[model samples]
Target: MVSKVKIYVSGRGQFAVQVAEALVEARHHVVGVASPRLRDGHSDESQAMSWDRLRAWAYPRNITWTDSSELRAHHIAADVDIILAAHSHAFIGRRTRARARVATIGYHPSLLPLHRGRDAIRWTIRDGDKVTGGTVYHLTEHTDGGPIAAQEHVLVPPGSTAQSLWREHLAPLGIRLLLRVVDDLAGGRRIEVPQDEELATWEPSMDSPPLFKPELIALPGSVSVDSSKWALHGQEGRDHSRPGSTA
Candidate 1:
């Protein structure tokens, strides 16, 4: 039988709730959940899994929930085994990571060693990449620099948007990857593979300037291609179309 571990979840949005649900379904003890309160202008998915709704769901299941913008080490229980950061914007301190008995893992929308920053899905689409994926990795002080635990790739359909990619591909794949990683940990297995720093590429944050200017390519018969080939002049630009760009 797989041993159940004590887990603390920190994040907001549908992804976080999905992870928490999966943990509970796996019979893991969810000690606490720290998430931001719902606000206007939040994404539809996030609003669907707001703190208040999660609290109601969790309370009935005997899971403690807290509404906090950030999760600190002090917020965690003494016997917490793992801390899972799912779709969280808050930066987890090194001290908090150390507090966990097993590890503090994070879910990244892009494959590690590439697109290691905020708005990974947006960047992938902006770059017009043919493929993209998700990564479940150990969390460190450095952003998305932690060693990888599990990864899965999906082909980016032509004219795919960030929202579509996330909803259709990355989100589902990420959940499965996270569950597999948790199972590995539960089975007393170390599953970290060191990331190659030399091959790493960092994308601009979500609030940064647009990565590429869309160019409408006239294709045969009423079909047009939204190509990301036209680089926005006067910005730090890199050719993401090159090989090894996506997962």
Candidate 2:
């Protein structure tokens, strides 16, 4: 695969630095960043630590940071082939979206077309899915129904909480999977299959439901389906046995 390619990162979240670090490890040229302004607005201690980590990590990577609050002419004027989003809640307009020569990939945790909104990892566990995996897909006007480009499956470990599982497991996996997608795209492999709308599911960005975890150690008086515990669902669909097609 091609090495040392130019890439742009969008988002002010922890995932931004994680992807940058991994890409640096793989020797990719991080051109610049156009994330939303960091909320020096109000931050608690844990939030501070995440910010500290982001600061410590990004400094060495030498990424040009743009306060998305400002104009894009500064960062988006550069030549780049890939645009990567980590915790990017904003939609891409023509300017930033046009910078990429190849494609822009949005990374989502749930086997999307399923959980199409925020708190995907938390929602999947809350919903009692037996299997949920990561998906990397082309970004379009819609939330996450875009055609899939590449995906990697990860199982939620046992006795995991929403806070613990995401903070620990899925976050790093997302960065790794996205870099793999970048490598695949760099290889001139642009094969994609349309998502099955019949099985498509959508979750609202707001109004989250009560998370269920099969509370096994509960008292006998309240022994019902452990709605609080998480289980995996829809994993068998990932086993792609089909042959490759040329672009």
Candidate 3:
């Protein structure tokens, strides 16, 4: 039998819950969970698990759960082997990241070096990219700029919406990738791959207006005019986007 690693998770939304549940089911010790309080009573449609549901699940398992606007290093114990950031808005500082025995892993909806910021999915759909995907990488203070551990490409069917793409492809792919990365690490595999800076691209925060305007265009050899547009930063001619791309 393989030894189980101790894990601490930080983030909100269903993705976080899914990671937590998987870790527990795999026999890993879940030390704690740090999540942001749900502002207002509005439920984010993109999230598969609710805060209440997560709390209920954790409490019965005797796990530590914390809900706050920020998750500091003090909130987590020093014995954790890995810190998983799943859809978390707060940045994990160097001090906190150092507490883990291994590196802090983060789940970004878009493939790194492209669509690095928020709303990657919306941008991809708006830009009419033929493919998009997810990545699990080491987290740094520089946003999703850490070295990648794993990535899976997904084809964007014609007329795809941000919600449909996430529900059908990105979310499931992300879960599988995260689990695979954890398994590799636990089995003593060093899988970090540094990203190429020259090919990197990024998007704005979720609060900002979409970086591109949707327009109708005809794909070569196809009679249908698909909705597409040029990205604001002028990083075009590639396949990219995110699961939670809508701000």
Candidate 4:
């Protein structure tokens, strides 16, 4: 039998809510959420579901939540088995991570050891990469440098915008990998693979200017994907427009 763990979520936007919902569906107790302000109503059609949606979903169910600023500014005292970071910009410090019984896991929208930064999806498009993927990794002081828990590659279609790529592929991959990692942890079968630093590449934030020339690096585990079959349709909270920064 698998144990249902207590989890604290750290993130914003639709992706974060999706993570919280998945955890609940998996029978894990979402003890708390540390994200942005929880608005009083649903997000407008133009906007992806924000922290407001999370507020609506969590409050009725009695899931306690606090602002991400608190998590960033000071230590949180939640007695959680794991801290799951999904699309969260705030940093989860060492002291906070130490509170988790298992480990703090984060979802990054790129293959580990590559595109390790705030604007991974943007960099993927700007660099003209044909392949990219998502990673679920243990969180550490190093940015997106934690040891990998799980990873899967996907294809980047020609002329694919960051919004489309993220909504269609990376986001779903992130949800699947995160759940898988959590389940493995609960079942005592969690795996951790150390990343090769030689293969690692870090890019600047979206605010920074684009690189003049693309850097060539060997992608080992990437496989070609038939994007038509993987194409996802309308879903509530899906961000249609390109995001400024996915950090």
Which candidate has the highest lDDT of all?
4
> Which residue pairs collide, candidate 3?
119-245, 120-242, 120-245, 121-242
Count the clashes in each prediction.
0, 16, 4, 0
lDDT of the candidates, in the order given? 0.68, 0.59, 0.68, 0.71
* Residue-level lDDT tens digits of model 2 in 34-90: 654444454554553434334445556576666544525346645788887666644
| lDDT score of residue 45 within candidate 3 | 34
Candidate 1 regions with alpha-carbon error over 4 angstroms? 40-56, 208-247
C-alpha TM-scores of all predictions: 0.77, 0.72, 0.78, 0.78
lDDT of 3 by residue, 1-247 (tens): 3568988877666666777888878888888877654533647735434344444456677888777345667877878888887766555778878888876887777767666666778777777889888888888655566789999888998878988888788877877887788888887885889987666766555644433422211212323422354345322111122344531
RMSD for each of the candidates:
9.9, 11.4, 8.7, 10.0
Candidate 3 ranges with C-alpha deviation above 4 Å = 39-53, 206-243
lDDT of 4: 0.71
Question: Candidate 3, overall lDDT?
Answer: 0.68
Better of 2 and 3 by lDDT: 3
